[model samples]
Target: MNFLSPLTEGLRGLGRAVLFLFTILAGIPAALLRPRLILQQIYSVGVLSLIIIVISGSFIGMVLALQGYRTLVNFGAASSLGVLVALSIVRELGPVVTALLFAGRAGSALAAEIGLMKATDQLSGMEMMAVDPIKRVIAPRFIAGLVAMPLLVSIFSLMAIGVAGGHAIGVELLGVDDGSYWSQINQAMHGTDIRDMLIKGTVFGLAISWIAVYQGYHAAPTSEGVSRATTSTVVVSSLAVLALDFVLTAFMFH
Candidate 1:
């Protein structure tokens, strides 16, 4: 009976999460009608996340270019480095890394903010005023995350492209042929890669937002509980991002 209790609780929680998701989705149209709310959250979650994404993308791109250059040079295929780097960024690293970062930054922030709101009885105050907190608060944040993710992934990939990404190190520093670099990328990269990136970004955004908001919404109205929910948001959102990336990669690439 004791063992079954945990399983039952997990199942019950899953059910609640699904229901909560539906409620948010139902409110999204209304939230969209109030684009200002969504825009505010976009600034909160998306714009604020750019510094980390840019810095991380730069480092990742530089490292990948350096390592790939060494290995490809051994094979006398150094010219293909640009194609390798671009494909890697567009297909895998861009969306996945951005999502992990988003989970850590925006996702945890969303959970903590909402949890604090709940703890402070702000949500209850809305109810007392006959307002739907779900419509006013959660849905806008969810929509903002959903809209901002693909944009963030695009920015991150751009960072990996020329600014501080592979091009800076692969071409200028490593003496790779400039024409071969861009031309190879033009030839090898395809529309499917872009499609895959956008799809993964959108899906990951939805999943991360759902987990963050749900955890916060249900958090016990206490300081410790809000803190736990915030921690859980980061942990669960990260695991979910990795798992979903694997699934998405297998489905899209394989």
Candidate 2:
């Protein structure tokens, strides 16, 4: 009975999470009609997240180039480096790394913002004023996250593929033929490849953002509670991104 308690609780939590997600999605249509609010949220979620994405993407691409180059050199197929780097950055690293960073940066921020609101009784205050916090507050942030994620992922992939993969390592360090580098990338990468990556980004964005808002909205109205919710937001969002990436990869590729 004790062991079953934990399992039952887990199932209950999962159910609540699903219901919470639907509630947020339900509010999104109202948010879409308010472009001004959505734009502000986009700036908050998307623009604010750019610096971390760019820096992380650059370093990750460089590291992949360095490691990939060593491996390919042994095979005497170093020119294939471009395709390798492209596939990695475009298909995997770009979306996964961007989502993780977004979880830490934007996801954490969303949770903290909402959690703080709860802790301060702002949500209750809205209720007293005949306002629904879900529509006014959470919906715009949710919409913004959905809008921002794809753009952020695309920029991250481009910066990684262009500067780190193409220029820095491929051109400067390894002396890979610039023409061949780009040519192989063009040959190996197809529309489906890009489509798959974007799909992952979209799904990840929805999941991470949804988790953040739910955690915040349901957090206990205490300082410690808010802090705990914020931490959980980051941890859960990161794990969700990784897990989703695996499932998405399996379905998309294999």
Candidate 3:
């Protein structure tokens, strides 16, 4: 029992830390009203994330098509491959997987950069110079992340669909008709599914960027601390995306 006490205590502390971060992020709206920060945030989250999203999305679609076609063919349901590929990529796998990759690539970078700024007191200096750090730093990041994620996800979804289409035409060996494939894709996609994916992407973006900034802001004032904060931001953001996915799925689908 004594040995278990330390583990329990550590868990409690971690929970409290996470809770505190949520409270701070929830309060970010107060800082988001500044115009300068909003533009910067838009650039950081939206513009920067585009390349990675496009590249990853294209490949994911191709891979999904390749794998999904194999499975469907085994069951002699190869004609429905487009429907399954589109739905899985657009509604579920696309947003979640892209977000996870984004978190690993960009989320950690954001955290480390911000953590370094915090450690070096650069953030404090901004405050001293009549800059609201939240407005200047956190607000843009939050807004950028929120705005960029959906756009990136949307781009990813489109590219993935394209790639899947190409793969089906070339590699699936399914002999599926082109018109049939597109018809199935169109039938399977609904306005609601699009809305759901966009919502999920937006929320994921906000959560990931917020986690990175929050971790950076609260990191220990040392280089080692910044490294740890960066790593933690990626891990926590990825887990949060999965957790939120389940919650959103229950609400949207169930």
Q: Which candidate leads in TM-score?
A: 1
The positional error of residue 212 in candidate 3, measured at the CA in angstroms, is 0.8
Best by lDDT: 1
Lowest summed lDDT window (length 10), candidate 1: 158-167
lDDT of 2 by residue, 12-99 (tens): 9889989988888898888778899999999999998888888888887787888888999899888888899889988998999899
Rank order (by lDDT, best first): 1, 2, 3
TM-score of candidate 1 against the unseen true structure: 0.98
Candidate 2 segments whose C-alpha is farther than 4 A from its true place: none
Candidate 3 similarity to native, TM-score: 0.85
For every candidate in turn, the CA RMSD to the true structure comes to 1.0, 1.2, 3.0
Report residue 14 deviation for candidate 3 (angstroms).
7.2
Candidate 1 lDDT tens digits, 1-254 = 79899999989989999999999999998898999999999999999999999999898889989999999999999999999999999999999999999999999999999999999999999999999999999999999999999999998998887688899999999999989989999999999889899999999999999999999999999999999999999998989999999999899867
Question: lDDT (0-100) at residue 166 of candidate 2?
Answer: 46
Which segments of candidate 1 are over 4 A away from where they belong? none
Q: List the residue pairs that clash in candidate 2.
A: none
Q: TM-score for all predictions?
A: 0.98, 0.97, 0.85
